[model samples]
Target: MTISVNGEKKVFEKAQMSVRELLDALEYKVGFAVALNTTFVLNTTYETTMIKDGDALDILAPVQGG
Candidate 1:
């Protein structure tokens, strides 16, 4: 399955993936929030939310600024 992640195209071995699983697969290490296909996916629901082919994912993390 192919999905656009942070504006870059990525291919996954599975046709479908849960939001949580995708994060684990990518080895995400920062505090972040995800937007899937233009919809906000709450962190509490990551395990249940599904990601499909041709989807767009924005993995945004908090940035520190003065």
Candidate 2:
């Protein structure tokens, strides 16, 4: 399956994947927000949210400045 991650194109071998799986694949360990096709995905829903082809996922992390 092909999807866009943070504006970059990425293809996965599987036809579908959960949000949690995607995060793990990306090695995301810290707090962040996930938006699928402009829709916000709750952290609690990560395990249930399924990603499909042509989907756009935006992973955003908070930044701190001095």
Candidate 3:
């Protein structure tokens, strides 16, 4: 299936993947906030949440002050 990650298109081998799997595969930082299909995905619920095709995801990380 095809999906968009941070505005870039990506094709996955399977149609469904949990948020944990997605983060692991994409190598995004664990502290980042993830928005899937315009909805925020809680860090605690990533392991149980499922991602589908054509989903638009935005992974944002916090930056500390200097």
Candidate 4:
């Protein structure tokens, strides 16, 4: 399956995977919020949430600014 991560398209070994699994696969830090196709996915739901083909994901973290 093909999914776009931070604007870069990449192929995955499989299409069915939870958000947590996906992040784990990419080694993303746990402090970030996940956006699936522009929608926010709850962190608690990541374990049950499934990502599919052509999905666009953006993992954003809090930034400090004054």
Q: Who wins the lDDT comparison?
A: 2
Reference-based TM-score of each model: 0.91, 0.93, 0.87, 0.92
Q: Ranking by lDDT, best first?
A: 2, 1, 4, 3
Q: What digit string (tens of lDDT, one per residue) describes model 1 on residues 4-57?
A: 999999999998999999999999965998999989999889999999999999
Compared with the true structure, what per-residue lDDT tens digits does model 4 show for residues 1-66? 899988999789895788998999999876888899999999889999899999999999889999
> What is the Å distance of residue 54 in model 1 from its true position?
0.2
lDDT of 3: 0.89
Tens digits of per-residue lDDT for model 3, 1-66: 788998999999988899899899988765789999898988889999898998888898889998
Q: Show the colliding residue pairs in model 3.
A: none
Predicted candidate 2 versus true structure: per-residue lDDT over 1-66, tens digit per residue: 999999999999999999999999989987899999999999999999999999999999988999
TM-score, structure 2 vs. true: 0.93
Residue 31 alpha-carbon offset, candidate 1, angstroms: 0.6
Q: Which stretches of candidate 2 lie over 4 Å from their true place?
A: none
C-alpha RMSD values across all candidates: 1.1, 1.2, 1.7, 0.9
lDDT of 1 at 60: 94
